[model samples]
Target: MEHEDAVGRRVYGTDHDDPSPGPRPGRIYRELLGGPLDGQLFDVTDWMPEDLFTGALLLAPLGMYGPGGRADYGPHEDDPFGPWIWGGDTP
Candidate 1:
């Protein structure tokens, strides 16, 4: 059997190409609903597609309350992956 190399686990699915279809910001600034709601998050959460939200939720780190951690992989370094993982600054 042939095995495939997996790098960066999936957030929503194995298909990494299916990026979110809309704006990825968690909050939106709106000016309409008077003072309190003005310049505040408009609660557009209900407007977002379920798949996109769920997929992002999966990608988020459960412990950190988010997955905003930064990961930089260098070509010449080896450890988490390997030097030969790629030939440039990124894989």
Candidate 2:
């Protein structure tokens, strides 16, 4: 299986001497399918209510180059495990 790489390439805060802990438990990785953050892997592991997967979510567009907006995404209807489709954005 092909793995999806995260857009957050630079390691922040972690000490250079420490070894990577690897993937954490209870991590739910989902891909953002559109908008300025397209193809970005979003981790929705600790989202409340559990049904958050059934509704759209508003996320800050920090991943986009020179961000100044927000992106909205909804769960894909056909594939529950699929990428979240972009709904729109706000400036």
Candidate 3:
């Protein structure tokens, strides 16, 4: 089953992608499916068309680490609707 936040934005969990609820009507969201951010939703509805986001996504480090470190996630097989897989952390 899928869930929605207080204002009705979809919130996908780590082990719940049933495709039954499907995506929200006009929302552009991606799923993170591994590493530190497994099962998290990434909302990209406001991104510009030419941002060139096909490369690795750098997120804040999850565990104890120094500053300027990040976790990486790469696009999974070029799926337009994505579930980006984790690539590890750089510290």
Per-candidate RMSD vs. true structure? Answer: 19.5, 5.9, 7.7
Over 4 Å off in model 3, which ranges? Answer: 1-25, 48-56, 63-68, 78-80
**lDDT at position 9, candidate 3:** 33
Summing lDDT over every window of 10 consecutive residues in candidate 2, give the lowest-scoring window: 1-10
TM-score of each: 0.17, 0.55, 0.54
* Candidate 2: residue 54 lDDT (0-100): 72
Model 1 residue runs over 4 Å out of place are 1-66, 77-91
Candidate with maximal TM-score: 2
What is the total number of backbone clashes in candidate 3?
Answer: 0
What is the Cα-based lDDT of residue 1 in candidate 3? 15
- Name the candidate that leads on lDDT: 2
What are the lDDT scores of the predictions, listed in order? 0.23, 0.56, 0.54
Give per-residue CA lDDT, model 3, range 3-75, as digits (tens). Answer: 2431333344312465433355566666667776666666556666444256345545562343466667656
Off by over 4 Å in 2: 1-26, 54-68
Model 3 quality (TM-score) = 0.54
